[model samples]
Target: MIAITEGPINTQAVIDAVQADGAGAINVFIGTVRNQTQAKPVIQLDFEAYDSMAVKKMQEIANQAAERWPIQKVAIVHRKGTLQIGEAAVVIAVSTPHRKASFEACEYIIDTLKQVVPIWKKEKFEDGDVWVAAHP
Candidate 1:
């Protein structure tokens, strides 16, 4: 499952989506909004995305991970729009028969998602705001 939403990402729901009977290890990655970037304080983050394209890219990433590893299921949920500090922006869950595969696949999904997903983030700062790469 892959989704680009305008609301908060439910980490538990993501995990539940990937639960499988034969999978023993379920790995999850939750990306949260941080309070600062490069020593500058941030007020909040506003995310925007080409929803359909972003979801397609996420599904592609999941497909690649599944092909590269022995994984049973994959779920990625990314939230857009305004978000406060410490709020979850993305949640990824992967289930596999072994722990190593689960960990590796989960890592690959998040890393690749940041690189290829068509999502943008605006850094709201005290001085001003700028739209930078969504993940940097």
Candidate 2:
């Protein structure tokens, strides 16, 4: 599952989506907005994405994970637009038959998502703001 949301991410909802009866292990990764960065106070953050491309890339990552691991389910949700500190920016939940595959696949999904997903973040600090690479 792949989605682009505009509000706070429901982590439990994501986990629930991926927890299937055959899945013995469920791994979840949540990316939250930090309040401080490099000694600056971050008020909030704004995220943007090429929805078509982002969703496609996320699907690719999920497909790759499915191919590599015996995963039962995969759910990836990314937030777009402004977010307050501590708000979840992204959520990834993967469940498999074993713990090892779940861990490895979960990490791979998030790492690859960061590398390839066309998502941008604007860190809104008290001092100023800066556009940087994907936030995790």
Candidate 3:
């Protein structure tokens, strides 16, 4: 499952969607908005995305993870629009029969998503705002 939402991500829902009977472990990654960046105070963040392309890219990442690891299910949910500090912007859940694969795949999904997904983040600072790169 993959989605780009305008509201806050539902962590519980994402976890429930990726849970399975055969899965022994589920690794979840939550990306939250930070209060500061580059030594500047950030008030909030505005996320924008090419919705259709972002979801497609997320699914591709999930498929790649499934192929490389023994994963049972994957759910990636990313939030758009304005988000305050500490608010969850993205949630990724991956389930597998063992802990290692679940952990690895979950990390892979988030890293790959940031690299490939067509989602842009604008950092709102007290002085000005700028569109920041999705990945460092």
- The numbered model that scores best in lDDT is 3
lDDT of 1 at 111: 95
Give the backbone clash total of model 1: 0
What does candidate 1 score on TM? 0.96
Off by over 4 Å in 1: 134-136
Clashing pairs in 3: none
TM-score of structure candidate 2: 0.95
Ordered by TM-score, highest first, the candidates read 3, 1, 2
TM-score of each: 0.96, 0.95, 0.97
**Model 1: per-residue Cα lDDT over 13-126, one tens digit each:** 889999999999999999999999999999999999999999999999999999999999999999999999999999999999999999999999999998989999999999
Candidate 2 residue spans exceeding 4 A from truth: none
**Each model's RMSD to truth, in Å?**
1.1, 1.6, 0.8
Candidate 2: tens digits of C-alpha lDDT, residues 1-136: 6898887888999999997999899999998999888888889999999999999999999999999999999999999999998889999999999999999999999999999999998988766889986645
Error of 3 at 56 (Å): 0.6
